[model samples]
Target: MPSAWLSTHLRASRPRVLAALNRAFGDIDVAEDAFQEASLKALKTWQQDDIPKDPAAWLIVAGRNAGIDAFRKKRRETLTAPEDLEPVHDGVHPEEELTLSLDRSVYRDDVLRLLFTCCHPVLRRDQQIALALKIVAGLSVDEIARAFLVQPKTMEQRITRAKKRLQAARLRYEDPDGAERSARFSVVANAIYLVFNEGYSASQGSELIRETLCEEAIRLARLLVRLFPGEPELRGLLALCLIQHSRRRARLSATGQAITLEQQDRLQWDRTLIAEGIILLEAALRKATPGPLQIEAAIAATHTRAARYDETDWAELDRLYRALEIIRPSPVVSLNRAVVIAKLKGPEEALGQLEQLAAPLERYASYHATTAALLTELKQFSKARKAYEAAIQHAGTEVERQHICSKLDALRSRVPGL
Candidate 1:
């Protein structure tokens, strides 16, 4: 009966265990098999007695034992590994290894190390994403398919190809050095952030936001920042996640409608995270390279410092976005900066900025909604009504589509011409 919880624990532990096993034996098949075997042990044992206090640690110890045991039972008893790989059974004792049970950090290192390897430039971007989800995030091939809007078989094939590519490249379970180090680190940062984004806000799921994704992202950001204290960009990324995450509580209304950031309750924001974000951003800015994260954190800091939504410093934000554009110009960032423009000048000025920039976001309802809002501000009711109608066409969620329809109806109410 107690075995019920075992499924949940194993699912969560799979990615971490895979990471640890691959690091220990340098073989994905062995690592995966060991984790599966360890899950069996947990199911058989936990029901008889109390579950281990630190279940992840217990599972890790079990996995190591399982891996070495299988390695010893290999096809050829006299087989020898290369100089880079020592036999798992060579002078290794499980009792001594289990003694380090309290040190759960050791097992966690594999997940982090695997993350670094998967994000290596040698791997294609899709490969990096699939590998990270397959390994670090513990997403099944089916789940990854749903996330990417692809078929399950397609995702399975993608993962298979990525794994083969990773092995062919002989990617090590260690962070690279010098030029490779800096580049590889950025990929790792991006992968972790993407995982968190998926969890924080589900792209394909019915829910507006997924708390698990958000928590995982924040956790990874914290881990990376701790591991690479000297790297300012890492710290900047952590700060950005922290600040954005602080507003999670107020993102959805009581009826589960997605609330705009300005409408979100400022008091509900996580003050601790905001303060930490500010501290991290300040530290990260010391390095001369003004990166995208630094700019994002700067913007988040401004929001965190504001007494109320109306009190947000638009001029400072405009200048910061300008700096951000120089570093990494993005349509999304430009759209965000337009909100400040609407506040400082007028909707017409903001509309001008939006028009000049090509928004590849036309297919997205949010893009249409934003245009409609600006048009409404300009008193161009007919145009606003038309944009809102278009917005409803692309709206992904029912709640968003309802809001767009309401906007369209409001315009129609004022003018029969609409």
Candidate 2:
């Protein structure tokens, strides 16, 4: 995964180089082309020269030279004598002096600027996320596809369409201000979270979870936090991720099976992450910014605090979900809301909710399995058997299929007629 490390470093520096080149050259195509040229040079240069002390500065210099060289070559092709067809810089501009002092434009706001550019108005939201992850985050097509729980070729087409949209609309590349930046920021966050979630869940990989991917997402979130310390929603996001990450070790059983939240070993959770999550969540809430992430973090906090499953604050969790629903409503949230109903109201009331969700729930294994589990708990063995069979039918992985099979066997054992 040396490429992974290199990619991160390179991606982190992209904005810096792109921003500087864009500022100096005043053209998006010219700046982006120069950044690509500089990246190639880094591939050749960094290995042989011990990696420049400031890689960003190195990239900026290389990119600037690239832009200048490209302009000169174009002029020669036109058979026109050079007449100051290059960037003119004023002497003593601190920015220019800083650019001079650097090994590259590593610290330049170019990467952020690049993010703003990729999520421009022309691109569809899904396409924007895909393209940004591809170009700015340095994720491969497979990686981007896995992130979105879709096929690689599908993601490839999405990104292709995104680029076409940007070209067709001729999207501008200047650093965006107030509203533009805010809108773009959401897409960037969603893209990064999507990457982290794929890595975290590993829907197709051998491992059920990849801690490194989660860590990478956490790192990205932290970087965003540093870039905008006063943003409460950002703090909520960071807080939510930290808390969930803290429970990773506790999530699996001894044989690597997926353990339900009610069954996890709380003792194995990372206190460091949990503590940090709590602190961040508190700070965010102090600003009264009650976003989805902040609410989710509070739910996680409630889980982390409980000494045992019986002690879990299901009532409080139910309340949190209710509040979260007010802010953001989805069938998934409604499904979760039913869990609280099962715990507090009764299996029948919860079953009503499940039945209400049948249109959306029919294809999902967890939805079927959860319905079956509730039936089993209610001693409705006949109904439970049917639900378990459905779970097996739709199960995405062998592990899930096996789990459902076990549930079916238990339900069959309880049935007398057969």
Candidate 3:
């Protein structure tokens, strides 16, 4: 089999297989190790023999066996009794047992259980998100580290600490009750959005986006929305992802440079996703219990509703951002509102608004980039050049750095020495 095909299959099967393994073994570390073992085995076996009819099922069975073996080894080393080990099945084959337990609903619940466990309230928010990205989304330690702007070692420690915390908490593998699910819903939603953001603008690498991460985040959001259909914020979260993902095709240039939203080809945007997002947003609005995610989705909806870049209702966007500021104020939100101010009130006013955010967002590349753009519009070439340089210095990814460089070059063309 082709390596790409194998890689894709393994990634797709990871959540289901790992979730099942976690349910069976009742240990995240064991489940993860077992899944890795199973994957390694598949690499050798599938190449020598024909691929299994159900790869995930094969993985689940293999992982269960691996977990049992690991336990047996530990039991022997510790002089533990046989009864303390995994139960031995008589007569029934491993595959048969796995098949009996392979109910789709059970797997779905298992996945949710794994997600909630990773996002347990006992862990800090960063720890929860890092753990979820690693365990549930299957992101690499390095990938999670890049997203968090930390070293791989630091991220690994964070994840380790989170797992230890979870182990201490002894969270149940059973599906959460209504109250429990609702309580954990916000953290889960935030983690999913962070996952989406990481994919939407990957922190590092040649590519500007990681479609796999985006797809995984969307899949998780879809599952969450299904589990909580009455929750407006959940609907809004899914809507936000769909609407943003709709522009994936048009977000990059032929040379792999990031494309500005205004410069993107509207025709390339996915109309189906946009339509669904709008419908979801409308439904959420009817509930009238607006949250940050709902407001963010509304902002995105406002952008998509415009027929062209010029047709965008800047005034409406300004109003929405002001509302967002009142509801969930952050430097990032303020930065976005500044862009709308630039469109409606000119660069001078936008720059004034951004000045207040400098202390809070000095290390944020987008803030510098936005400031540079506003400065350029005002024909303050020297200041714009400085801002662009600052943006490039703070850029998290090679693609982002290159994008800022391209803008800087454009600015230089307008001014001889800039």
| TM-score of model 2 (CA atoms) | 0.79
Selected candidate, larger lDDT, 2 vs 3? 3
The RMSD of every model to the true structure, in order and in angstroms, is: 4.5, 4.8, 4.7
Best by lDDT: 3
Give candidate 2 misplaced runs (Cα > 4 Å): 1-15, 18-33, 40-53, 79-96, 99-112, 116-129, 140-158, 173-180, 208-212, 253-256, 414-418
Q: What is the TM-score of each candidate against the true structure?
A: 0.79, 0.79, 0.76
Off by over 4 Å in 1: 1-20, 38-65, 68-74, 77-112, 120-130, 139-158, 168-175, 201-203, 206-209, 286-289, 359-361, 396-399
The lDDT, on a scale of 0 to 1, for candidate 3 is 0.83
Q: lDDT per residue, candidate 2, 1-418, as tens digits?
A: 5556655567777655666676677656677788888788777656632566566767777777678888778776666434543443422221354456644233325545566666665666677666655665556788767656678889888877777776688655555677766666666666656556655552355453256457666876787777776666777778878888887877666666666677788888899998998898888889885777778778879888888998888899899989888988877788888988899898889998999899987898888888988988888787888888888999987666766787687777777673
**Candidate 2 at residue 39, lDDT?**
81
> By the TM-score metric, which is better: model 2 or model 3?
2
Cα lDDT of model 3 by residue, 1-418, tens digit: 4766777778878888888888887889999999999888777666524566677888887777778888878776776434534543522234555566677678767777788788777888788778877987788998877766678999999999999988888776455687776666777788888778877874354343267668878988887777567789889999999999999989988877889889999999999999999999899899998888989999999989897999999999999999999988999999999999999989999999999999999999999999999988998989999999999999988888998999999999889976
Q: lDDT ranking from best to worst?
A: 3, 1, 2
Model 1 Cα lDDT, one tens digit per residue, 25-86:
78776777888788788787775356665566566677877876687678346864445344
Question: Using TM-score as the measure, what is the rank order of every candidate, best first?
Answer: 2, 1, 3
